[model samples]
Target: MSKRSSISRLPDEVRQHIEQRIAEGQMTLDELIHDLRERFPEHADDLPSRSAVHRYGQKLDRRLAAIRASTEAAKIIREHAGDREDARSEALTAMIQSELFESIMELQEASDEEMPAEKRVGLLSKAAKNIATLTRSSVTLKKYQEEAAAKARAELLAEQEERLEELRGEDGMSEQLEDRIRNVLLGKA
Candidate 1:
């Protein structure tokens, strides 16, 4: 297997600093490298070359951009669509499904020589578990929604029955009339 990039092997705090500098949109790769070397003098020789830093910075920029776009899209959805019928959750589920598909495709195309057999199997197993979990959660959500609708319908029927009793007592309404109303409301008429 190819060795990991030098930047990838940097300490967590240094990586976070690099990511922060990239996000701030204020520093060129050379400047960032210079700053890193100045701050971590002991690691000056270990720091990656400019091209490596640029590649890492570009990847981080893409990730940050994706995050910004996602946040903006969610804000617009909330403002206009308001998550009615749990649309937000549905959107997130679809996003996850798309990501899972992409991950599976990547795994399928990955070079066997570059990755170990056991690691590939582990990744595939994890993907399968994710799919199963997502399916189970979706089914549970649908069942919960159905139960909620049934409960609401039952409450409406009870309210209607109470109103019918009032009419029967005060107006002496006929039993046939009440039966007709019930049938109509239940869509049996």
Candidate 2:
């Protein structure tokens, strides 16, 4: 049977705490190690090596960066929502293309020279296609959401009209009763 790595064996809560600390950038690696040792004295010997912690921190940072990028993209798309359709599409396409270019540059820099040329080309092609698809999807998604919202608004209005009609019918009957009462009181019934 395979044994779990020290980092993997740590409780989820502990790992989460470490990741949070790493994300905050409030402490150095040595300080982080010391703090963990102090906090989990019982498992001090079971803690991951400094290098493992550093790797984990790097991975966490990458994930966080990706999330931030996605959020920024979403914000950009939403900000263009009130624009004309063509304007919105152009804005989205520009934004996505710029991001894709930056991502390709970063990937090229990070990729090892040992990586196959074919694989690299394939990756770039896929990324370009993905950016194009994302640009198209963003516009389509906004249209669908707007349609759904309008439909919901229409349904709500219909329901309200039905309710108002029922209230108006009751109001009319009440008025008729009041008129009859007035006639009887005047000895005209």
Candidate 3:
């Protein structure tokens, strides 16, 4: 296994401090490292160099940016989508499928000589199986959404029919008119 980074070996409080400082975007790598050493003298040796700090900072920055982006996306989805769990789930699954597709394409482009044939084949096989499973999941979600919607529509129609029963012959409404309304609502007219 690869050795862990010196920064990774830092104490929890120090690591949290570094992560917070990095996230705040106000500290340079040199400034952050200097401050870390000064603040945590006993564990200064565990602190990373500027380059290592830079690498870790970049990784953390990307993660924080992704989180902010996702937060913004969720806010937008909530504002417009309005409790649309199925739409969100479908969109998330699509995004995952797209990422998997790109990764598989990259793997396909890599030569077998770069990796052992069996290992590469195994990876591809796993990818194919995942794609199949994801597709099946998408199909199942669609069917579930459809079934739930149909059930809801049936319930609403039943309630409407009950109201129609109550309204029969009231306000000069006839059975013929109610039948017409029911047929129109049912798309059988």
State model 1's lDDT: 0.81
Candidate 1 residue 50 Cα shift, in angstroms, is 1.5
Give the alpha carbon lDDT tens digit for every residue of 1-189 in model 3: 134577788888988998999988898887998898899998866778899888888888887887687678777878896733466667678878988988877777777566667887898899889999999999998997888788878898999888777777556687688789889878899
lDDT of 2 at 1: 14
In order, how many clashes per candidate? 0, 0, 0
Model 3: CA > 4 A from native = 1-21, 32-85, 111-116, 169-172
- What is candidate 1's lDDT per residue for 108-148, written digit by digit as tens? 77787867778988999999999999988878767776776
State each model's CA lDDT, in order.
Answer: 0.81, 0.73, 0.81
**Pairs of residues clashing in candidate 1:** none
* Winning candidate number (TM-score): 1
lDDT of 2 by residue, 94-174 (tens): 667777888788667654554566877788899978977886887786786687678867786677656545655744647
Better of 1 and 2 by lDDT: 1
Q: Model 2 compared with the native: what TM-score?
A: 0.44
TM-score of each: 0.70, 0.44, 0.62
Best by lDDT: 1
Indicate the worst ten consecutive residues by lDDT in candidate 2: 82-91
Q: Give the TM-score of candidate 3.
A: 0.62
